[model samples]
Target: MTQMTRSAVGGRLSDDKRKAIALQALARTESIRVLAERNGVSGPTVKMKTCMSRG
Candidate 1:
């Protein structure tokens, strides 16, 4: 993955946050849509994060 600059707009989530959210999804704590909405990202983004966390 390419590194994003500090000045970049609409910043991406940190790896830690992404991992936490992925874990939550795996644990069934909440719906993926809810997690994505609460995190200000799209559902697909959350889904992708979860997929990445798997491997």
Candidate 2:
């Protein structure tokens, strides 16, 4: 599992926000690094978002 921060992606992103990010990641509109940077999180967290959405 990727290391998750307590307030990664801007002071704890909401479920909906995570979903949006996941969707974007899945759609290939945003790279994990880009999303992570934009969201103030780590690259693995972006990957986790897409993975967890499928799980």
Candidate 3:
């Protein structure tokens, strides 16, 4: 698998912050792709964040 650069990893946001943002975005957006694009992150990353937050 390809590795993400630090910036591409959304390092500016802490895990807690990322989860909060992901949750809010997931609630408001129809597509994870669009939310990830808007937040400068990968869709799988956002999906993982949501899953992590839940579990």
TM-score winner: 2
Q: Per-residue lDDT for 1-55 in model 3, tens only?
A: 1227524567677777797766866586568777776677777777877777677
Estimate, for each residue in 1-55, the C-alpha lDDT of model 1 and write its tens digit.
1113311311567878878878987887899878766776666677877898889
Clashing pairs in 3: none
TM-score of each model, in listed order: 0.73, 0.74, 0.64
Q: Candidate 3 at residue 20, lDDT?
A: 71
RMSD of each: 6.4, 4.3, 3.7
Q: Show how many residue pairs clash in every candidate, following the order shown.
A: 0, 0, 0
- Rank candidates, TM-score, best first: 2, 1, 3
lDDT of each: 0.69, 0.75, 0.69
- Which lDDT value does model 1 have at 50? 85
